[model samples]
Target: MNTRPIAAGLFDEGASPRLRGGRHRQTGRFVFPCPQGGERDSYDEVRLASTGTLWSWTIQRFRPKSPPYTGPEAFEPFALGYVALAGQTIVEARLTGMAFDAIRIGMALRLTTLPFATDPDGTTVLIYAFEPDGDRAS
Candidate 1:
């Protein structure tokens, strides 16, 4: 089966995947998934850091409303969090590879991807996420 990122220009699929972010040309502020259309002109496209510290998190116990929630019909709870990319910006992403209770603020995390859903054509769509970084965690 073929695989693809959930959205174009969202992240790279190289040996080390990185989220595609944008740096404001004036303030140097960073934003994820890069801006589109006219807003694209004022920023420089950059790959985001692969590692970060978990800033905050919460458990998503119920299936989110549709139109945006495209997961499986049989809903399951999930963990989502904001990860601070050091001097860069904090990014909101799903947390994985650990139990919800194990997640901690300031815990080291690494960029990763998870299978979101399969397209009608059978292509597995992947979404960006953050996972515990065993090597860097205290």
Candidate 2:
């Protein structure tokens, strides 16, 4: 099956998975990757750091509101957190690999893709996440 991102420009489609962002020409400020300037009013494509530290997190014991969620059924607890990318944007993503109880602040993490679900056309939709780089994503 072909692997595809949940959304285009979410991560690098290259050999290594690094978050993609845009650097504004006007202020050198960064924005989440996209065409014609992503989040920023104007920008140039830039590759973001893959390694980062867990800044903060929480165990999501309940399912989120619908519409934009489309979350899992039966709602198993999952950990979500912000990863501080040095000298760049801090991304908020789902934390995986380690158990929810084991998630700790300041833990080393690396960019990795997680399988979300398959589309009607049979393509696999993937989501990005920060997993413990201790070994799994190392």
Candidate 3:
């Protein structure tokens, strides 16, 4: 899918966000899907669109939770935390494409896609990430 820039200097890995749950779900819930479906439980992960501020973050100086979490475990640490999207929802994602010291509360951030890992069958997993807004390096 073609990624596009959205409001407040945010860019998603897809064109436009797919609003899930209509009005039944809480406002600000977003699901990023490909032009089609059939992967990773039908792409049901909630992602941010345009307006989010970095509420807070924590540096993961150790390995992540479990299988499928394919980030650095030994040498390089990663950041994990929540971003406050508009409408009173906080979305948690991996922080990328910037230095740890550079991250601060209220910094601008947007959705990103990074190569997660390769499955035993080599299917490859692409995951959602968040980086400084408008910086494509993320």
Candidate 4:
């Protein structure tokens, strides 16, 4: 099946994916997605760390309102959280590859992807996510 990212410039398509972030040319601060349009001129595109620590997270139990939520009609709970990429910014993303109870703050995590949706043309749309770095199944 053909596969594609949910959005362009979000992450690199590689053996081990890395999020594409932006570093401020002047301030040296980083942002998850490199800005667009004229604002992009002030930032330099940079690949972010592939691993991070789970800072905080919560279970999304309810189906989110539409117009944005494009998942299956049948809803399922999922975990999401902010991962601190060392000296870089904390990124909010879906947490996967483990059970909810097994999740813990400061747990080591690594960049990954999950199937978000499929287009009529049969293209699988993938979204970036974070999962436990090593085996911690419980």
Candidate 5:
């Protein structure tokens, strides 16, 4: 299972799992591993969320500089963008599983987890992405 909780102390009201330095039940803080950024201790707050609009986007014509970039070299075109979450901090990520022609500015988007690819060393890279909100992408 994708143990990395998409929602943790974020929506849950409390003394704050992060502020208290306690491990979050969903995303896991002090202990367990986070599939997204991996086991250290950065997801200590609500830095990102699903409630963002498609502020802007662009199609990349070349492969990224890392192994996790799995888009076909022949294809040479993929979407990436900055998702402005409800609060501060903007999440830079790829926008996929949708058609470029249909994507537009100011569209509703939700947070999603995407499996990039396995590295030569055998570590699976997970990426945080956003997808158009079903029926609310306008």
Candidate 6:
């Protein structure tokens, strides 16, 4: 099936996925996907480092309020966490392939694209997920 991001610029299109962001031209502070406008309104697109340490996390067991969420009628609990990038922003994303009890602070993680859902038009929408950093061969 043809795949596409849940949103563009969330990650780079390449052999490996790299998170994309915007950096403030003057302050050098970064924002995920894009940057918030400043007084001068200067910003530049930049690829964010894919690896970061797991900061903190939680499990959302209930369906979130509608109007924004458009998932299936049946909801499944999932892991959500904050990852601290080195000298960069802390990103929040769904956790994958890790047991609930296995998550820990400072653990290594890598950004990845995971299957979200198939759209009405038959496009596979992929969302970002942070997984335990390691070789898949292992």
Instruction: For candidate 6, write residues 36-104 as lDDT tens digits.
Output: 446336778888888888999999999988768866668888898998899989988889989999888
- Encode model 3's per-residue lDDT on 1-138: one tens digit a residue: 222222222233453332221111333334333213343343334433544678889997766675755543444677877877776356677788888888888888876666555555555455566778874223
**Model 6, stretches more than 4 Å misplaced?**
13-15, 36-41, 135-138
CA lDDT of 122 in candidate 2?
80
Best by TM-score: 1
**Regions of model 2 farther than 4 Å from truth:** 33-41, 135-138
Question: How do the residues 43-62 of candidate 4 rate in per-residue lDDT, one tens digit apiece?
Answer: 99999999999999999999
TM-score of every prediction relative to native: 0.96, 0.84, 0.60, 0.94, 0.56, 0.88
Off by over 4 Å in 3: 1-48, 65-75, 135-138
Instruction: List ranges where model 4 is wrong by over 4 Å.
Output: 135-138
Which 10 consecutive residues of model 4 have the lowest summed lDDT? 129-138
Full-model lDDT, candidate 1: 0.91
| Tens digits of per-residue lDDT for model 2, 2-28 | 888888877865457877877878877
Q: How do the residues 30-138 of candidate 1 rate in per-residue lDDT, one tens digit apiece?
A: 9987999999999999999999999999999998999788887888899999999988899999999999888889999999888888888889999889998989986
Better structure of 1 and 3 per lDDT: 1
Model 3: pairs clashing at backbone N, Cα or C within 3 Å: none
Better of 1 and 2 by TM-score: 1
From the highest TM-score down, the ranking of the candidates is 1, 4, 6, 2, 3, 5
Q: Is candidate 3 or candidate 6 better by TM-score?
A: 6
How many times do residue backbones clash in model 3? 0
Off by over 4 Å in 1: none
**What is the alpha-carbon RMSD of candidate 2 to the true structure?**
2.9
